[model samples]
Target: MHWGYTSIGASTYKGFDVSYTDLIGTFGINFNLFNNDVVRYYSGFRLGLIWRETTPFPAVGGALGFDIKLSKFYSKIQFYLGMRLWTDYREDQKNHFYGDSSGYKRGLITNNALLQENGAIVLSMSW
Candidate 1:
């Protein structure tokens, strides 16, 4: 289980800037494919919730990575690197309009789903 936070800023098609933050919590299990005194390889699945702009959405993803022992005497300290991919689903309640040349005046509300992918590089000490 882990908790993570991310802040994103981007420009929209209308040339406006917007920013938002996401709070995420995940619970999953990992299976070790290979292990030794210096390094270990593993893969896992994740099911979690993502809270953005005070709204909660569901997220599901998986990870594949390895951990390298960083301390010779303390095996609990390690460096981790991984690749993760997930899908986030949410409802779009705001107005969305086409370009002025399209002659579309009314806005549309629809459901939106986003695919989020990221990599993690971390140094951790476990008790």
Candidate 2:
């Protein structure tokens, strides 16, 4: 079990600059390549609750990265880049544009359909 967090000073969302934060939690595995044990690679799926001006929604995706074993204040450090697709992202964002609407415009998913209209690039660090 692992927990994470992130903060963005500025970012581009649909061509506009935005700022936000996230609280993340993940479960996955780490494997040591060639059994060297010095360098380990890891991949996992993640789910984050995005906190932004518009609304809070879940962004879920996977990540791939590695762990470097360093002898210092932080013995193990990880750098990962991930893509999180929002479950409530509308294709046109018209709902956010028009205050509110019915049906899918209001972030609804129907009959086995996944709301995958939006996504986010995630860069994070952990020790």
Candidate 3:
């Protein structure tokens, strides 16, 4: 259990990321929210896969979904649902107890084909 941020360089413009990693027994739960939203209330949550050295940013393992209400100009809400293609990661130090096998590598998998099995839903209403 820990929390912190990383700076790529010494400049006003910087990438920010926060994560929560919990290893309890044989299972774990990881949840993170990225703030790339043009607006403050439009951000989303990435829930799944905890922290892994291979990944530079937190990710949502397994099935994932999110909903966003773009500014107020639009009458419809944007929704998204998808599943992570999984990854194959290996630890530098060989430790058989934890199995160093992964389906994909961190950073290697992004908005590419790995996250392609995704869908979007829109509902419009006038108020």
- Report every candidate's CA lDDT: 0.42, 0.48, 0.29
Query: Candidate 2: deviation at residue 92, Å?
Result: 11
Q: List, residue by residue over 16-61, the lDDT tens digit for candidate 2.
A: 3444455656545667757665455566566656655666756565
Q: Candidate 1 residues 42-117, lDDT tens each?
A: 4555555544345545555555555565667745444544434443332221222222323322223322323344
Q: Check candidate 3 and list the clashing pairs.
A: 87-102, 87-103, 87-104, 88-102, 88-103, 88-104, 89-102
> How many clashes in each candidate?
0, 0, 7
Q: Which candidate is the best by TM-score?
A: 1
| Model 1, position 97: C-alpha lDDT score | 20
Candidate 3: residue 31 lDDT (0-100): 40
Task: Report the C-alpha lDDT of model 3 over 13-113, residue by residue, as the tens digit.
Answer: 12323222322111233244574432111222223333334332223433223224344454344333322223322222123223443533335445232
Error of 1 at 58 (Å): 1.0
Please report how far candidate 2 places residue 28 from its true position, in Å. 1.0
Q: Per-residue error at 79 for model 1, in Å?
A: 6.3
TM-score of each: 0.50, 0.44, 0.19
- Model 3, stretches more than 4 Å misplaced? 1-77, 96-127
